[model samples]
Target: MNNQTITNTHRDTSLGYKLGVFGVVITLLWIGVFKFTPTEAAAIEPLVVNHPLIGWVYNFISVQMVSNIIGLTEIIIAIGLIVGFFNSKVGYVSGILALLTFITTLSFLATTPNTWKMVDGVLTTNFFLLKDIVFISISLLVIEHNKKYI
Candidate 1:
């Protein structure tokens, strides 16, 4: 191959590796957050202000069980992505989940009362949603480029 072709190939490979690493890191970080952190403080109580839509859902349903189930599912998906198992399915599912979560967060922000009155407003401090968006984008890119690795 020509030098230009070689450089392009190398760049593409590097991007894939970087995206894969990002996916794994993000997966682990969320797993840690959900598994180790106090669910009440981190999710239930704070979500009232930070993610009121989710909070309302929590109030309307079995918050603890549903949250735990979701957390477990995330951990499983993350493991699959990190270990390179069924990556296409995982990538697509993860992307969908991330998108849904982001949309729900937006809905939560819109529905919450006096959302902007608090310094720790849901929209302002919702890095989880933003990070998920990044993760979803990188994951989709990695899957597109490294379908064989999956």
Candidate 2:
């Protein structure tokens, strides 16, 4: 293709990608605020405090400010991901936030000690751990896929 045509094609692709990323970020943020429906209490029911380390982590993460900050930062990162589409600096920041989120999630899960007693005897903690893994994977995907556009 001619230079003009090639440049136009690239611009269109980049614009489309940026828009798509922005849309996804908005959807995720909305779901988190509305549909994810985090209760006033934590998602995991408290396990019997049999382990000291687990107990310590659990108590620490339960701080109101800590949880609130985590939630707020999640929203901020969503914004960053949307804006990051237009600039490399924002994209890198978003990636860093995602990594931080992964770390926080790991600590949250680890602190809980054990899953609630399910009637069917299914271990639910594994499900949460898997979800966190998926979150990390998506963060990586965002970083990898949009690095070029950013």
Candidate 3:
């Protein structure tokens, strides 16, 4: 490819990366804030209660408190990701956290009951969780992109 073409392609790739990070940040921020609401807390109760690893949290705290803690964690992660732009170490840590976040959410697909259903002959599951796969990919990319700086 020509030098100009290569430059354009690189620019586009960089823009796409920025957009992906922005998307993840926005999603996490929005969902994290929503987690503070009673509606979201109740909605997630079933999934959270069914998880093998974290289900015990409900045993010690009220559902709303659990949701609040999760929300706070997410907000912190989002801030970490933002700061990561300037500090590679922070970015790497945030990327790993983001990766873990997505992975944990994806796990709900298997841990949560009745997550799958046959709809019109096609087996479907909680489509919301499926997006985490893409988020996970972005998190990995974020890690790789920051590794050079670290």
Candidate 4:
């Protein structure tokens, strides 16, 4: 409405954008590092076991192996995203990874909703998977905002 109000709004949105990128960097890097560990690999076993899209990875490679690859990729992507903060090209690539990661995780809701369990008819999995939606939204925003640079 007013110039001052518009300026404040713009500033707030900019801060939110920066924070979102930082959050994604921290979260993905932390989780990505752990993905290589036995604990993290075991933790995702059930989710992977029931997954329809990528579950077959276990059939070709051991779960641990698959987890290792995923972890390494995440680390690389995290690095790229950090670079993206300064370099739009790298950021674009990391943005693609973020989009794919969240989309895949969200797909889990449909492929293996049973893993999340249902109580009173509502799937508990929705709660767990819903977080991906937020992450995806952040990724989408990052992508949209970066389109000008790309």
Per-candidate TM-scores read 0.52, 0.57, 0.90, 0.82
Off by over 4 Å in 3: 1-13
> How accurate locally is residue 96 in candidate 1, as Cα lDDT from 0 to 100?
49
Runs in model 2 with CA error above 4 Å? 1-28, 31-38, 41-62, 116-122, 126-129, 146-150
Residues 43-117, candidate 3: write the lDDT tens digits.
999989999999999999999999999998889888888876666678889999999999999999999999999
Q: Model 3, 90: alpha-carbon shift in Å?
A: 0.9
Give the count of colliding residue pairs in each prediction: 0, 0, 0, 0
Q: List runs of model 4 lying over 4 Å from the truth.
A: 1-13, 120-123
Candidate closer to the true structure by lDDT (higher is better), 1 or 4: 4
> Lowest lDDT 10-mer window, candidate 2?
40-49
Q: Which one wins on TM-score?
A: 3
In terms of lDDT, the best-performing candidate is 3
lDDT per residue as tens, model 1, 40-109:
3356344443454455555564655555655665565555555443244555455445445435544544
Clashing pairs in 4: none
Evaluated at residue 42, the lDDT of candidate 4 is 95
